[model samples]
Target: MIEKAEGTFESVMRAVRGVTRAVAAQVDDLVQRPDVLVVEFGVELSAQAGAVVTAAGASAQLKISLTWNK
Candidate 1:
């Protein structure tokens, strides 16, 4: 049970890291300068361990505010 929980946690962390890297790459590739602000980043995870099942999942969202400087 503990091993499964650890695996799930590691998977979640890797997903978070990948998302962060992708977001940063997108920002770096922008050719036009725009005022951008990250308003919120959130992650929620839940797990259920039962006699016959072990399930885990996560939901995440990111909100950003952008203004055109032109």
Candidate 2:
């Protein structure tokens, strides 16, 4: 399972990219074994702060959870 894959980036898009990469890595690891059946995948994005000044200053957090039935 993957959890708390959080990152601060220059923009929300970048942050999402980071989280996506993290999740993909985890999924790739699971799929490599050939016997794992990935049953569920979940992602949670935390609420953004109200006062985002600029794209260069934006931040985001992500949580990823994965469940497999072996």
Candidate 3:
């Protein structure tokens, strides 16, 4: 159906936009809709060579929603 195709196109567009934003942004915290808030964060932690390492130097954040919304 045409509606299904339109929906798919919109979904693809939204995903592309999200990817573009994630790449072009450092900190992304915004409200997705009236009842939903999407916060995407990426961080990099660099530890001194002599210090203990808790994580890798690079991190990639993904889209996540809080439990309260559910």
Candidate 4:
């Protein structure tokens, strides 16, 4: 039982880490691009674990807008 609980915790941590990395990358990209005027991102995650089954899923959406200064 302890091993199963540990595995579930590890799985959840990995998913959270992945999401953090993805958001960091997006921020880096926006910072490096001089033409970016506005940016937005949406992230969602779902997980299920139980004695009989385990599942996980994630999704993300990004939007960027740019305009000329002159």
Per-model TM-score on C-alpha atoms: 0.59, 0.38, 0.36, 0.46
Candidate 4 C-alpha lDDT tens digits along 1-70: 5565567667656766776677557666863544445655565545656432235455767666665554
TM-score, ranked from best to worst? 1, 4, 2, 3
User: How far out, in Å, is residue 7 in model 2?
Assistant: 18
User: What value does the lDDT take at residue 6 in candidate 1?
Assistant: 74
Which lDDT values do the candidates have, in the order given?
A: 0.68, 0.45, 0.51, 0.59
Query: Which residue runs does candidate 3 get wrong by more than 4 Å?
Result: 26-70
Clashing pairs in 2: none
What is candidate 1's local distance difference test score?
0.68
RMSD in Å for model 2: 10.1
Query: What's model 2's TM-score?
Result: 0.38
For candidate 4, the TM-score is 0.46
Backbone clash count, each prediction separately: 0, 0, 0, 0
Q: What are the per-residue Cα lDDT tens digits for candidate 1 across 1-70?
A: 7777677668777877787788777777888756764545687767666531146567888776656766
- After aligning candidate 3 to the native by TM-score, how far in Å is the CA of 52 from where it should be? 54
Q: Is candidate 2 or candidate 3 better by lDDT?
A: 3
